[model samples]
Target: MSDASINASTVTTQTRVNEASFGDYFSLLKPRVMSLVVFTALVGLLAAPVPVHPFVGFCAILFIAIGGGASGALNMWWDADIDKVMKRTKGRPIPSGKVEAGEAMALGLALSGLSVIMLGLATNWFAGAFLGFTIFFYVVVYTMWLKRSTPQNIVIGGAAGAFPPVIGWVAATGSMTLEPWLMFALTFMWTPPHFWALALFMRSDYDDAGVPMLTVTHGRRATRWHILVYTALLALLAVGTAFSGIGGPIYLTVAVVMNALFLRGAWQIARRTEDDSEADNYKVERSFFKLSLLYLFLHFGAILAEALLKPYGLGGWS
Candidate 1:
């Protein structure tokens, strides 16, 4: 690019440590984000109609989690420049110079192969193949391509995150089915409003990093409206899943309650201006962001409960 840009990137990569700590290496894994991946993947595995041996299930999740972390490291490696510019990510392993980008890349590549192969051996080729594709989609497609180029980056790239539950299901059943896709849809649809809320409050982060978030490309008002629309769509899909094969009284009850609150939050966000947001310090947006974290967990937890209860004729519509 330009000399100025090169200089800025150099400044961003300035070192913080002469030697990386064990924790610095672990930080490359993006453990917090990986936790969500593992949780949802576990829920998917457990919620499948078929059964997995406890040890097999444990191995499957462990591998999937590793695959998730691999994707995280690769993402950090690629985004190190932007990470340094973005306050939310400046402290990450690569950006803060706790670990070299090459080190992160090597770790990511090694883990990618290891996780995929181990997952395949422990579960099935389908699950292994799915994990490999997810890493490729996140690192190659989203991180390298869509993230910097378009506002719709999250809309499409979200499929990578959504795949975990499907992989979990496949690990158990060794094949695909409609039920796991419903879980996929739940996370897919939830991603937008969930992230947009964060964008609402963290607009400056994307702006500073030049990431082309919805808030940056479309403006805050449009982003707010987008959140409302997506939340509405997510609510419909969420509530509708309650009537599907995976849905039962418990899931339905949880869906209705959480979705109602989610929609209300979206509505409150939509009915505001930049002034309104600034005046309240984006309190509603921050609340929505916090709620979004729990939204997926509780839904998956409900699904897990439903699956666990199925043996007693208590789960799903029987």
Candidate 2:
């Protein structure tokens, strides 16, 4: 193209980018993801054996939420190019032309530094540093590197999301222990199956975007088998956590019921032929995807319930 056309194109892109409003900026932070981070972190904080000051606890959660937002912003900025092509992500702020890539990077960097420094001051440096590391892992390691490089991206990258609970535990007790790692493992192990279920139904998006999701690289059959395998392993861990002191009768019951249902869902997905799946338009896969959300939530909810009832001598293993 001529210099004039190039210049015009740049200006048009810039103008649209500059028109970003408050809501557009907010969308860059990935609010749905922020909610999950907040909920899981809150559970970790409350489930700790030590008590946290109310104000301090609130601040820790706030900063953690901000850090989670920072990661989302940076992720959007980096993934904007790919986001434009994928049906699932085409409407994101940067991809939709509502927010500038530079603006996203700036907001992400600002929030990352602010949240880390404030968290350290509000709680302890350890928790602060963990939050900082989580951001780095998500933005630099997972988003920039692993995402395009391999299908195991989400597998290894899931660690970034799993760290929140451990950070929350540290923020509350000023140290780490076995119990928080159980929470971490719960989310960590749960990540693969949860996401693989999504990849099953959303296969086209990954293929179109050239993303190396399990379904795209490993074939849907391999992906289904993977889901079933992970779900089985996840079931064993979930039920065993009940005997791990952090879980009680309530958690045990929830674990047994949920994991059983979860495994059955995985099995159904695994047993389906491509034709079988197409017959109902991936109904079982979609159900499993929805159920996966409820599955993690209820597990954490059960843990929270156990912790809340602990003071009343009504929670945990007797």
TM-score of 2: 0.94
Q: Write the per-residue lDDT of candidate 2 for residues 104-130, one digit (tens) a residue.
A: 999999999999999999999999999
| Clash counts for the predictions, in order | 0, 0
- Tell me the alpha-carbon RMSD of every candidate: 6.1, 3.7
Q: Model 1 Cα displacement at 75 (Å)?
A: 0.2
C-alpha-based local distance difference test score of model 2: 0.93
The global Cα lDDT (0 to 1) of model 1 is 0.92
Model 1, 11-34: lDDT tens digits are 666533246889999989999989
Say what the RMSD of model 2 is.
3.7
